[model samples]
Target: MSEQDFLRRLPEAGHSLRRRDRLQHRLHLDFTLLLLLALVAGYGLIVLYSANGQSMDGVQRQGIYFALAFAVMFVTAQVPPHLLRRLAPWAYAAGVALLVLVLVLGIGAKGAQRWLGIAGFRFQPSEVMKLAIPIMIAAYLGRRLMPPSLKHIVVSLALVLLPTVLIMLQPDLGTSLLVASSGLVVLFFAGLSWRYLLVAGVVIVASVWPLWQFVMHDYQKQRVLTLLDPEKDSLGSGWNIIQSKTAIGSGGYSGKGWLEGTQSQLDFLPEGHTDFIIAVLGEEFGFLGVMVLLALYCLIIARGLLIALRAQDSFSRLLAASITFTLFVYVFVNAGMVAGMLPVVGVPLPLVSQGGTAIVTLMAGFGLLMSIATERRRVSR
Candidate 1:
């Protein structure tokens, strides 16, 4: 009675598995990574609602950004890694051209000329460099040997610094540093020698003085001075950090309860929805909420590293690792600045910060990671 039914069901089960495989192959999605990203983005929307004074408007806008960002990720994942490698140099060239254009005819706001406007739309060229630099370096080095020779290293550094110097001229220090780091991460992943790294570290240490004296603007230097002694001018340049620290400390371990923090609600904490959003999370949901968000980030990063490790080619490995670690740097800088451990640099909290460009750029990076994650499967098939 059961033999014929079992045989018939076996074919149906096989068909279902085939369909699932086809879908995964077509989409090139890593479901686990996607789910983790969604969780963090959802958590961010919750915090944003409270941070923005319980306003639904900001939350709705951010939700729309997330939707668009996820779609970008999905479409990007569908692109083949080989195709990305092929496109890297062009992308890098275009980004550099845009950076030059920004300096020549960029829009200025709040004493910085960083955005290029066209047809009533404005965007940061530096943001494009964040992804471009890594991809370009990876593509260049991936074609050559591992542990790049001095010539390749020099070439890579040149590639990194050109855009960096341009962005710095725009006087947006945070983005310039981030753009530089993204390219350097590719070099690091390419197995640069320890001697080179040590020398570079020393050079950086030695250059700090000159960088401060000649390269750094007065306001940038002032930020450093403010970091050292925030109390000296608590009512002026120091106000932001002082208020941020106060909000974080007052939250204790369990927070002040969602949307109940006097610091944010009373409007003492400035930029609570943007660069200083972590302070809002600390004040509202407490330290526990911050840790939960970090845990999600750690999971996503681990998945990215796993993908990098599994990649069959050097381009995928280098690009994947660079994207993952660049994300870590973003989180580190934002949290450090907000907590007064580092000078205020306008780096936003990864997925949690309320911003349009950063969210899309970050998700596109995750898309690249997803493509690399699935490349091995496609190759094996």
Candidate 2:
């Protein structure tokens, strides 16, 4: 296909990404975002390579995943936002149905049963909710004739919470929290009332203690309690937190310098290639390295928000904002969990962690954001 014809796509189809517009803007080629993802993903490759200890397969596969994820990001960027909007409700429904199936036949791994196997492919339904809830809520609020009302806000919250409660039932606390945050962004962007926010806060506080006491599984409660002081149970439930802290604090300023990290090399911190990779970064890269990484993430998210601000339609605006904010939460939660400031939530570091599905999903979200930011539309900016 011709370049313009490729990127600027069909109207009814929603995608308008023509290959010709690939370099229409200077900002699209910014190195900060790529640098951040590369360093983090690079660290995953390093740690996974070592963690394998026997073969380089894990890291190699992850390298392939990174390449594929970036490719998806590129392709999605070429598509238009309206296309994604049309897909939102369908995506949400499919996500929920899949979650229900997981509740029935999900393969239990670690401490939760959240994945479904198809032939040789294994999928996590919770990941779908991460993307779906935001899109669904954004589309709903954006479609309102006027700014959303309390009733509309309540509906939005329900859209967010339904999946949260269901996922929590799977004991997938990490994903459930992420899904909640994703929905919150849409409500916030939709201009929800402060009264609603206050009410939600009160409800949260009222529920937390009871939830902690009764609703949370014993291990889940232990994670929260352990976050306060991992040393109290250093040898038991606190080991992960304590090790993560040690790895971070020991890095000081300039880091131990790649691959030279003793903690990661010794395999003291758990899930080095997955949830705890931030700990690996902290151990090897030190304080300065973290700053660099954070800067990159900030740039990427900021760019996404900028795109949302310029969106020609409310749905596109809300969706873009929610996606950007949720990306922020992913980095924040994972880093917080690894730094011992928060409990280990089993959340992967975006782009950096070694998970395949998360990499693809998050990259796809970025692509959609790029599409929203760049596409020419009928709606006013």
Candidate 3:
């Protein structure tokens, strides 16, 4: 071709390139899941603004967190599921190593040593385990048999219990439970036997006494006690539950309007910008707002499960299901605790709560779901 002819073709080439880029972008992102996530995160910012005494600081910071989270999600979605399967064991090992490092040179807040401070930035290693454990289990079991044989189930439980024990030792009951549940969800989805599940339930019931007596810390026990009777020490450890319940109850049907929550504004509700943010939503936006938020969550969960069902491999299916169930646990625990129906375990509401680590981790999970949803199986002639 002549140089002039090549030059003329360059514009057409550029147009084609732009078209391909748009197509690739569309293929790479899951619009339905993304929309649901954005809706919840946007609603979160609104609720957060009110919860933070109408201050923009919380909302502004959370917005930054959301941006970072979306970026992580996008990058993660670009990674193929096969690569993720290959990387799971390594990721899980690294996470467990970090947890060990935290135990050795950990930082404390309030009373628990659950964070590792690296060059002035603090992070909870337990958060990584929440995803890592499930990934590791899925990678391990997916390559093996379905409904995992007894031996595999034993191994899976060990994988879960090790991290759970470590995190519990960190005295972080909330995160430990979440991590444990993540691994268990993978096992369940992998087709663990019903008989095994029943036995496990009985064991859990039998272990509660020992867990409370030997495993739980004084404060942890106090939380359980407080859950039973918040009024027993209304001015002490019970104060949080009391105020949270009051905030939720006072919201009635329609809320008091944004920024007008008496409980949050008057500082009667603690952690209104974080763990108990749901109560703020309940108080300011009312019960209807809570339902809308829950509906968004349900849609996300439904989409995630649908993606899992359509996954081309067991790894994607198990990981997707585990991540989705973990999300359910997060929402359930946060809302239940705020409503005084469950013990306060410091679980932040999924994407709604103000936490960078949780946001990034969760978005990454969604990204993996997208990868599963969009991945096309290769065929050879």
Highest-scoring model, TM-score: 1
For candidate 3, report its TM-score.
0.92
lDDT of each: 0.92, 0.79, 0.89
Q: Which candidate's lDDT is highest?
A: 1
Q: Compared with the true structure, what per-residue lDDT tens digits does model 2 show for residues 1-381?
A: 997786666652453343323444323332344555566666567656654442477778888888988888777766666777788889999998998999999999877888899998898888878888988988788779556887888788888888898899887888899999999878887776788779878998999889887888998888988998788989989998888888889989988877778877887877777788777777777898778778778877887888788888898888889888988999899888888788888888787777888888898787777667665432333
Stretches of candidate 3 exceeding 4 Å from the true structure: 1-27, 377-381
Number of the candidate with higher TM-score, 1 or 3: 1
Q: How big is the positional error of residue 311 in model 2, measured in Å on the Cα after superposition?
A: 1.0
Model 3, residue 330: distance off in Å is: 0.4
Worst 10-residue lDDT window for candidate 2 reads 24-33
**Candidate 1 residue 354 C-alpha distance from true site, Å:** 1.1
Candidates in order, TM-scores: namely: 0.94, 0.87, 0.92
**What tens-digit string does per-residue lDDT give for candidate 3 at 1-381?**
999999999999999988865565556777788899999999999888888888898889899989999999998888888899999989989998998888889998888899888798777888888889999999999999797899989898899988898988888889899999999999888877789989999999999999888888888899999999999999999999999989988999999989888999999988888999999999888999999999999999999999899888899899989989999999999988998899999999987788888899889888888878777532110
- The deviation in Å at residue 91 for candidate 3 is 0.6
Clashes of 3: 1
